[model samples]
Every structure is written in structure tokens, then in C-alpha cells.
Target chain A: MMTYAVECKNISKHFGKTTALSHINLNMEKDKIYGLLGRNGAGKSTLLNIVTAQTFPDDGEVKIFGESPYENGRALRNICIVKENGMFLKDVSVTGALDIASSFYNNWDKKLAERLLIEFQLDKRKTYRNLSLGMKSQLGIIVGLASRAPITIFDEPYIGLDAAGRQLFYDVLIEDYMENPRTIILSTHLIDEVSNLLEDVIILNKGEVMLEGNSEDIKNKAFYIRGTKDRVEKHISGKKVLSKEEFGNTMAVAIFDSISDNEIRAMELDDLAISSIPLQQLFIFLTGGKMIKRGDINE
Target chain B: MNRIKSHLKMHYLNSKKSFVIFWSIMFAISALGILISIYFKSRGYESVIITNSIVAVVIFGAVSGMVCYNETLPYMLNMGITRKDFIFGFAIYNILLSLIMSVIYTLLSIWEWLMYKLLGFNYEHFGQFFSGVKGIFEMTWICFLVTLCATVLFTLIASIYYKKGMMFLFGIGALIMLLMFIPGVTQAVFGFLESLVLSCAGGKGYIMMTLYSLAFFLLCYLIIYPLARTSQIKR
Candidate 1:
């Protein structure tokens, strides 16, 4: 029996007039790198916060290690959340932050921290305020990975890092996880960068779980079908059309259905443009490209 | 028990530097006061004794509140410590820090006594600063209570501000100021407190005030628990 690491049942939250999370139900298993992908205001942080007991949901319950996280210190002991903006104590040295983390988390790996310090090129003696934006983020990442908690969460962990630095983090994260199997919930906007590393992806759209499944399954779930407007419409008549656009007499339509390579090759002679939509492009089509106008619902 | 210990250790790590800074400043102030007393005695002026209990109380009181909001709450939570653990750990921190302060205050009084004995001259000192050799215990007791009272009260105030925002803080300040300006309110408040103090005067006073401080500490914790438990980290 594979035990779940995190389970949210009918969770919802609101801030005055704004709905932060609305009836979100999710279950995550142990030892997999889960990607929590969402556009801004898509309730990614709110869901992660509720899971870690950082914020209370307006409705429903959350369980970690098969126990409610509310006031459940034992359950939370195995969890770690690294926020986008550094939540480190102000004016404290890097070593001081690590010391405090080591004290709280029984499973803290000091050696990992020391190694990551070299990898990230962080100074232990420097105060948190003295670090550059990227350095501050690196410090947060070091703590998150080195804590060695069974359930580690990074809510947009790499906020301000160059390409090379981010690649270093992803490589370190995957290598570390491979050596030590644990549940990791990573939330980030740089979808395609970390997409391949994710085993499962959860997409949140306006405070609800829009799509979720095994990453490979989801990647093969959607494809683009292009041809004349009539041919494309005839081809996708029985399939779910996620979005469609027309350019002169030609049309490109996104279908939320898996198409086999044989069928795709079969349609090649039809003078149609056929290509699979990557996870990042599907994510944008599903959640992004919605610029709000004066009054109408923008999609 | 482990939760409390972890949280306490966590807070201790975060605040240890600040505590040392405050301690050094207090020691410098005490050293300066002692030097002035020695200089006055040499200049044919009356010898003086400047004890540190009052100064320690005032400084500790101011610091106790800022510690909670000074990135402590959010940092602790982000580190996976629960709110229950946080409050328990914070209480431990307050008791531990205040006890250390009280001991230092007592030691400063002892140092002053040694100075008086070495000089072989009676100093004109604020006699209440240290009651006597007996005052050492009393002074420690008083400092502990004052420290507890100040910390818990400030924590409560800070929690309120954290949850309620600047408008609420301004409203509270305005209401307090308004009440102060009203006739007889300030006198009534101070009179009540003074009477409470006098009622617990002598040996009875220290014990009673200590009990009161403990009661007030718990009260403050109870008042702030819900707010702290439900607080979310804001950007």
C-alpha cells in the first residue's frame, strides 16, 4: 500500500471579496517530485500554505502523514516550506539561520548544507540582508534541501536566479532526491525549465484544480491539429477543443485528446500541420492567454 | 516536550545575538554610571551608587515585544514549527531571557557593594535600587516580574498590530491617548496599580507580584494565541 504524503479534501479559502482557493481536493504520494504549476492568483501559494498549516482553509481538512496539520506539531516536523521571498530572520547570519533550522528539524543534514554552500557559493558569515536577490534565494534553497524533511515544499523557490544558477538548483535537487527518496512539492512559473524533472503536475486555475495526473500522461494528453477551418473542425468534431484560432483560411486547433503516432502519420497526407503541445504550451493555453478586458470574461 | 524544546532552541538561535547586544549595552551603561560615581567621589562630591535593575527592566521591557514580530513568527513557521510550538518556545525564551537579566542585575548590585567596601566610603545611592544584601533577592525578583510583564504585554500588543493592521494600531493609540486625557482615568489606573503594589509590599509584595506577572503572562498568551495561530506570512 502506497501511503499518501499530503491529502486535501474539499479545501477552500477566501480573502474578503477575493477567493483564494475554492474547493480544492488533491492527493500526493510519497517519494515523487510533484510540480504545482499555476498562473499568478491561481491559488498555488494558498494551497501550499494550507497544506503546511501556514494558513487555515475556510472549509475542509488537510492531512499529512495521515494526521491533520492544524496544531499537529509531530506531523509538521517532517515538512519544510521554502517561500519565494526569503522568510529568513532579518539581520541574522546564514549560519544562524541554519542553526535555527537544524534545531527545529531533527533530520537536518548539516553536511548537505555545507556542500550546497559551496555549490551555491553562499557565505555563512554574511547577514541575510547583505545577500543579493539571487543569493538570498540560494540560501532559501539550501535550507529547503538540507533540512531532509520527508515532505519538503518549495513555493516558487527560485525567484531571482540566472539561467545557470537555476539549472544548478534543478540538478542538485534531482540528484539529492534520487539519493534520498521523499515527497517534494515544487511550485514555479518557469514551467518548461523544471517540467521534465516533475513526475506529477498539478495545475491550478483560479483557485481550483484545473488538471492533474502523471506528468507523462498529461504531456501526451493534448495535441495541436492544424488545417483549413472546415477540415480541422471536421477532424475534432467528437474531441474536446481546448482552444482554436483562425489565420486567413487556415486554422490551428488544440485538442485535449491523445493522438497515436499512427493516426498522426495517417493524417500527414491531408496537408495538415500536426504537432504535440508541450506541457508548458498546454499550461499557457489552459491558464494563461487570458487578458482581462473592461467587462467581459477574458480567456 | 520535544516540540517545545525545538521551538525554544530555534528562538534562542534567532535571538541570541540581539540578547548579547542588549547585554553589552546595559553593561556599558552600568560601567559608565560606576565611573561617574567614582569621579564624583574623587572631586569631593558625595559618593554614589547606580544599580542596573531599573535600567535592565526598562530595556528588557522594550525589547521583548519587538522579538516576536522581528521576523520571528514567519521565520519559525516557515521552518515547519507549529504555532503551539512557537508560543511554548516563546514563553520559554521570555522566562529564560528574563531570568538571565535578573541574575545580571543582582550581580551588578553585588559589584556595587564590593566597590563601596573597597573605597571604604558610604555612597549616596538610590537606596531602592538594591534594598540591601536582602535587596539582591528582592531586586532579582522584581526584575524578573517586570521583565515577564513587559514581554508578555508587548507581545500581546505586537500580535494585535500584526493581525489588525496600521489602522487598528492607530485606533488603539488614539483611544489610549483619549482615555489618558479624560479626567481621573490616569489617576484611577495608576492608583489601582499602586494600591496593588502596596498590598503586596515587603516579602509578600514580591511573591504576589510574581504571581500576578505569571497570570498576566498567561493572559497575554491566551489573548494572542488565536491571532498568532491564524496569521499568514504577508509580502
Candidate 2:
């Protein structure tokens, strides 16, 4: 049992009449990359906001580094949250924004900030309002990474990045984590793209913790089966098939359950292509793949 | 203290243009008033200080109110600075700006008086016009009151609006000030409240006002504590 770096016990939040989160219990390990996977309005941002003290949970308590962070400068100093929209002063240049963050965060690494600035190719003189969407996302990633806090949360921090820019972010993030080793929670819909980087995954749906487990365990736990329609249907019947699709005589079924060696061997002779479902597809099946539930699921 | 200093430095760097514009506009208006006084100095003219004082109060209220919200609020919120520190930091900045404005006005008045004297106009009452213990006290009290009022209002509005409060505060304050010129509105409003309070307290003027101020400050603090505490919702 590792000592949890962050914990949310029995946390429930409501906005007006709508419940944003319900009885949410989470324990995050230190120095692990945890992906908070959820659809839009699935309370990912709200949960991040609550955990970072940007928004308070309507009920229950949160602890970061084993202390209540509300108004606790010592605790907050060790935590940083970079929201997707980028909270920055208008008319403040990129350099000015970084200066402000550097001054505020005692652990702020100026060298890292400068390095990221170069990597992002952001002009220091350019004000925040003038930055393009991708540049803004890069700016947020730089801050979130450079703060060097013990706990850092990035809520969809790569909102508008091109492939190369996003790749740079992912690489720098992993490299930095290996050296610095902080508890990082990345909340985003780009599940498959980031699945390889995640050590753990917490899937949230309809304001509840639908699933949480080690990344490898979750991958091993979920599987997909494809074969002739009758054989696939016969094998998947009453086996918690999350979803099934059929085209002519071929059929595909997604099973959110463990498969034994005998079961795989038995299914093999049925001319089927049994494969592991990607994390994104797993999420799509788990959430019923409604447009609202499968937020931004582009390959 | 270091955090505050950093914030102050950031504010100064951010507010360079606005500070210059505000100070220039204030000086320009006061200079115009002094020039008009100089034009009338040959016979008898001593309204420069009074005119400048009036203008100063108006400018201080408007400028302080707007600056209190615009210059300090967003950046403070963004830095996750507590509203208690916010009130403290903003008070420091507002006081400094007020002192600077007062000093500049005094210097400019003296220069205008010298210019009038150089023009061969008898300006024996220049010292009497600009220098008086009573006037100094009055100006100090008014400036302090304006800053306090604006700060309280801004804090309340900030708590209500959260991060977007500053923008809403500026627009609302401007609208309220514009409405102050309406006939009988100011008196009707303040007088009614004052009378209501006086009646409630049964003529306990000093004690009542003191209790009211303490109570109001306490209530404001209670409200701000939650908003400031909200800064760490997810941390």
C-alpha cells in the first residue's frame, strides 16, 4: 500500500440541481501518471478544480500531501493546476505571465521555463491575448510542467495543439516526470494517444467513478472478439459484452471482462480476430458511445 | 511579504501606461484650474486650492474605484492570492497612488502660484490658499474614505462575481456614479439610510457608526473568507 499523494474521500459536488460528482473516492499514488478519462461535462474539469481548490466540493473533503489545502499556502505552494483555457492576465506578455508565475511559485524553475519557451517558440513580447490556440495550450503546458510542484494537474492542457506540438508536450512531460517524479493527473479525452504514457487510468461517467485500475490491468481486463455472427454472438451471450456490431456474416463484440486461455483457444477456431480494445474504444463502449459521452473521439 | 512585493512589481509593470495616463489627466485638469485662477489673480483669486481639492476628490473616487477593480483584482485572483492579502495589497497600492497624486498636486499648485507671481500679479494669499491644517486633514479624511469605500465595494462585488467580478464591478460602479447627479437622488438615498440608522440606534451617533463599521467589516470578512478559500477548490 503506497502512501497516497492525493485523496478525495466520499466527495460529492452539485451545481444547482445537477450533481457534478457523487461519492467520489480516489487515492492517487506519488510519482505516477494518472489519466482522468471522461466525456465533456462528465465532471473531469470540475473534479480537477475541486482537488486543486479552484472549486470546492459541495460535500466531503480533499487532502493534498496529507493536509487540507484550503488557504494553506504551504500546501498550495506544492501544487499547481494549469487549466485548459489558461488563466492569465489580458495584455500581459508571455514573458510577463511567466515572470508572475515564477515570482509566485517558490519551486518555479526558471531554466525549465526558458527551455520550454524555446521549445514552444513563443515570443516573449507577445501578450497572452495574441497567442494562437496551440500557442496558448503550449504556454499552459509549460507552466504546468515548470512549476515543479509535488502535485500537478493538467485539465485538457493540450486543447488546441498540432500533432508535433502535442508530441513535444507528451515527450517533455514524460522526460520531466522521470527526472522530477511528481504526482501528475492528466484529464483529457485523447485517451488512446496518451494511454501509453499513463500508469493508471480513472474513468468517470455520469458523475461517478465508473472504473479505476492500473493501466496494464485495465488493458488485460478488457478485450474484443470478432468472428462469424453466430459464433461471436454465442461466445459473447450473457458475458457482459459492452457493445456488438455486425456487418453481413461477420460480427464484432467488445467484452469488458477477463478472458481465460481456454476461452481464447476456443474462440480461435471460429475464424475470429480477437484483439485488445484500445483505451479510447474501451471508454466508448463503457459510456455507450453516445455523442455526449464520447467527447471528441477522433482517431 | 515577498509574494506581495512580487505582485506589486508586476502591477507596476503592468500599470505603467494606465498610471501615466491617469496622473497626466489629473495634472492636466488641475493645471487648467490653476491657469484660470492665475488669469483672475490681478484683482483677487484664491479658488485654485478649493477647485483642485474638488477635482482631486472626484478623480480619486473614480480613479481609485476603477483602479481598485481593474488593476489589482484579476491578477490577484489569477495568482490565487487570498482576498485578505488582496485587500491589504490593494490598500497599499491605492495609498501610494493617493500620496503621489497629492504630492504632485501640491507641487504643481506651487509652480502655478510662482508663475502668477512672475506675471506681476499680487499673489499674497498663495500660501493661505494651498497650506492649511484643516484643509490637509479634510483632504486626508476624504481620500481615506474614498479608498475605503471603493475597496469594500470592490471586495463585496468580487466575492459575488468570483473571477469575473472585476469587470462587472467597473461597469456597475461607473453606472452608479453617473446616476449620482440625478436630482435629489443622492440625498434621498443617503439621507434615508442615515435617518433609518439614526432612528434604529436612538441617536447614538459615534457608538452606532463604530458598531456599524465593525459589523460591516466583519460581515465583509466573513464573505471574503469563503471566496478566498475557494481559491484551492481542487488543490
In candidate 1, which residue ranges exceed 4 Å CA deviation?
A227-231, A247-249, A289-299, B34-53, B116-134, B169-188
- Candidate 2 residue-wise lDDT, B111-148, digit = tens: 65566567655443322311332344443433343344
Error of 1 at B129 (Å): 6.0
Instruction: State the lDDT of candidate 2 residue by residue for A8-76, as single tens digits.
Output: 998898877999998889999888999999888888888876776657788988988888766566666
If you assessed candidate 2 against the hidden native complex, which CAPRI class would it receive?
Answer: acceptable
For candidate 2, give fnat to 2 decimals: 0.37
Model 1, position B46, has a per-residue lDDT of 67
What DockQ, between 0 and 1, does each candidate earn? Answer: 0.66, 0.32
A1-299 per-residue lDDT for model 1 (tens digits): 65589999999999999998988888999899999998999899989888988888899999997899887878888899998888887778898888877877778899999999998889889988889899989998998999889999998888778898899899989999999999999999998998899999988888878888889887786789889887777677777667889999899998767677776776676777887788889888788755322112111
lDDT measured at residue B186 in model 1 versus the true structure, 0 to 100: 99
The DockQ value obtained for model 2 is 0.32
Best by DockQ: 1
TM-score result, candidate 2: 0.77
Off by over 4 Å in 2: A289-299, B27-94, B100-145, B148-152, B160-235
